[model samples]
Target: MTGLGEDVPQTAGAIWRRTVPVWAGLTALLVATLSLAYVPMGRFGIVVSLGIAAAKAGLVVVFFMQLRKPDPLLRLTAFASLIFVAFLLTIIFAEVLTRAPPTRPGTVMPRSAPDMPGLGQRAF
Candidate 1:
């Protein structure tokens, strides 16, 4: 079978036109996401940060890669890539979620040290 009717009109221009807005939005999102890095979110921060990255990648795949108009095989290939990425993320996330937060070399200050019921109690 002569794939793509033997001469697909390389519509690269159309692809770019669809993606320019996506790229601009992505840039703005990246700046905003980076700003969040300075703000403290504790544990949830990592999840939110990565979620934004995934969304940007999704936009690139959809608009830049023209996934919406592709053949089923092409779509399947994209899906396979997503599945592979998800597998890697699962492993990395398992490691991250299980590992303990790093301990500082200096004294470990309690989160509520200033408000403790007995700041200097030897025993109950």
Candidate 2:
């Protein structure tokens, strides 16, 4: 009768059982990421790594942070933030691609001083 009115507490075993799948999933994802690091895809490797990282982040946010059970607005906000980040990245890449090639420093020095009609002889 002592616990009649109170909410039944979940047993530690039940909690572990429920969380075990999540733990396994995270571990598997970690292993996959590690394996992906060794595969050579040239430039596409960056895209693949970023995709895997995004998946891992999504799992953490959805399960560990319990975002899926919360109000819809929270999910919307998270998506909006991701969209903003993508926009920022697009702008950065655009600027990088359009920029002129870098020139070596100190490669070009003034060969001779500019001529000055009004000034007297220049000092070396």
Candidate 3:
């Protein structure tokens, strides 16, 4: 009965633990996000929002979701999707910036309006 209680080890023996630096980095990022919430950045808001979202999403995918593990194809697929989305965004913005809208300056209608012959006024 002398050695009956010696089986338990110290708390450090659990082995499963997260690094302090990672938690610290995440906390800092979170604090930065909170601080940005109070600032009125206007047009810059979209850029800032996307940047922060990307950083936060990267953290979630890399650490929380452990996407860096075995299946490397997932990483490639994600990168490819980002590329395609960026390409699509570029095309949409280009079109929006280059296309001109129809207008009749001072008046409310176009100069060359189409003459529509209603069924009741048309002669065969």
Top-lDDT candidate index: 1
lDDT of 3 at 121: 64
Task: For residue 85, give model 2's deviation from the true position in Å.
Answer: 1.0
lDDT of 3 by residue, 1-124 (tens): 3332345353653323443555677788888888998999999977887787788788877766656665567678878888999999999999998866546355344234356555686432
Give one digit per residue, the lDDT tens place, for model 1 in 1-124. 4453337454889667766889898998899798998999999998999899889888888776777664788799999988998999999999999866658466455656555667576331
Candidate 3 overall Cα lDDT vs. reference?
Answer: 0.69
Tell me the whole-model lDDT of each prediction, alpha carbons only: 0.79, 0.76, 0.69
Off by over 4 Å in 2: 1-15, 40-48, 103-124
lDDT tens digits, residue span 24-105, model 2:
8888889988998999989999998898788888788877666765467777888898899999999999999987655756
Model 1 TM-score, all chains together: 0.56
**Evaluation by lDDT, superior candidate among 1 and 3:** 1
TM per candidate: 0.56, 0.57, 0.47
Q: TM-score-based ranking, best first? A: 2, 1, 3
lDDT of 1 at 69: 66
